[model samples]
Target: MNPTIRSLVVPVTDLAATKAVYSALFGEPHTDESYYVGYNVNGFEIGLNPAGNGGGPVAYADVDDLDAARDALLAAGATERDAPNKVAPGVRVCVLADADGNPIGLRGK
Candidate 1:
């Protein structure tokens, strides 16, 4: 499977406040905002996960075979927060944390 880091989720308390700061820094408004506000910085997406329980920044990586990757992580001592499932058309993912509790989002690309 070809895996590449895609979007990174940055946990924040206030979306409005963070958005303003990011906008000024990047010199561009967010490209879209829904469940999460997303900004396209160059080719990478920097997102604000306001309601995330992860408590830190998360790296969402693009994977060709999410199930395979999930299995590999599990075998290598990672715990599943959610099983791989389709979240949208042509898109699916799951959250996994290594032994140290850092989040890595395996995504459909």
Candidate 2:
């Protein structure tokens, strides 16, 4: 599958403060939920999550096939940090850790 890094998610300890900062930086949020806030900037998505698990930001690649992309990553020595799971009706996301334990996110529709 051809994947592109279209999203970047940052973990925040303070949701309100973080949301305000991102809102100021990116104009306004496209999505505002208790768990996640998303902003669209020139076709790319910037997301903020209070419950995010990783140590730093996660870059999410947009993929046509979530399973295929995940399998390919695993085959290439990436460890699964989170299995592919549906976040919305048609959106699915998975997390993988690189050799250095950096988190990478995969999103599919």
Candidate 3:
């Protein structure tokens, strides 16, 4: 699939409090764990990561080829915030920073 921003991850200091707020807005989460909590708001994902990004939410663009896409972004001056890692079976994710230090996440199969 072409890259599209469909997933958003927010780093939180207080998981319980933040989870409550998101739950109220988006209903119950589809995936819940101590490391990560994810809600499926329609097709898009609203995630709460207690130990993810330090700043704001990171929007993830779903891509077909993770390595190729990441390399292209690096060539265009996007710095690597995090290397590609598998979060689930057949699913890999990585974070990159644009020129302004804004995070950009990529997820692929």
Candidate 4:
């Protein structure tokens, strides 16, 4: 898959404050909870997470096959930051770190 950034999960210390800020910009969140707050702007998904990458926002690229995409990145020098985990019924996600330690998020099956 192309390096198409479909969504972003921002790491925040305070969910309530961050949610309020994003809510003002993006309006009501489609999914809101203590763990996550999600918004859909157009076809792009934006999320807020308190326990995230521990740095900046992570960009998740939507793919058809999560395993293939993740393996490709790992073979190309990326290291696994987080193993594939199911976030939703059909959606699995993972985070990998590039050579320079930039987080790469994959969202798909």
1-109 per-residue lDDT for model 1 (tens digits) = 6688978877788878887887777766465464577778888888876766655887888988888888888899999875676756988878898998877789983
**Cα RMSD for predicted model 4:** 1.2
lDDT of 3 at 6: 92
lDDT of 2 at 13: 91
lDDT comparing candidate 4 with the true structure: 0.92
Model 4 misplacement above 4 A: none
Local distance difference test values of all predictions, in order: 0.79, 0.90, 0.93, 0.92
True lDDT of residue 39, candidate 1: 78
lDDT of 3 by residue, 1-109 (tens): 3789998999999999999999999888998899999999889999999988696999999999999999999999999999999999999999999999999999996
Candidate 4, after superposition: displacement of residue 102 in Å? Answer: 0.6
Question: Which parts of model 3 are misplaced by more than 4 Å?
Answer: none
Q: Candidate 4, residues 38-78: lDDT per residue as tens digits?
A: 99999798999987858699999989999999999999999
Let me know the TM-score candidate 2 reaches against the reference structure: 0.93
Writing each residue's lDDT as its tens digit, candidate 2 over 1-109 gives: 7789999999899989999888888987989999999999999889998888858899999999898888899999999988888888999998999999989899996
The window of 10 residues in a row where model 2 has the poorest summed lDDT is 49-58
Error of 2 at 98 (Å): 1.2
TM-score versus the correct structure, for each prediction: 0.83, 0.93, 0.95, 0.93
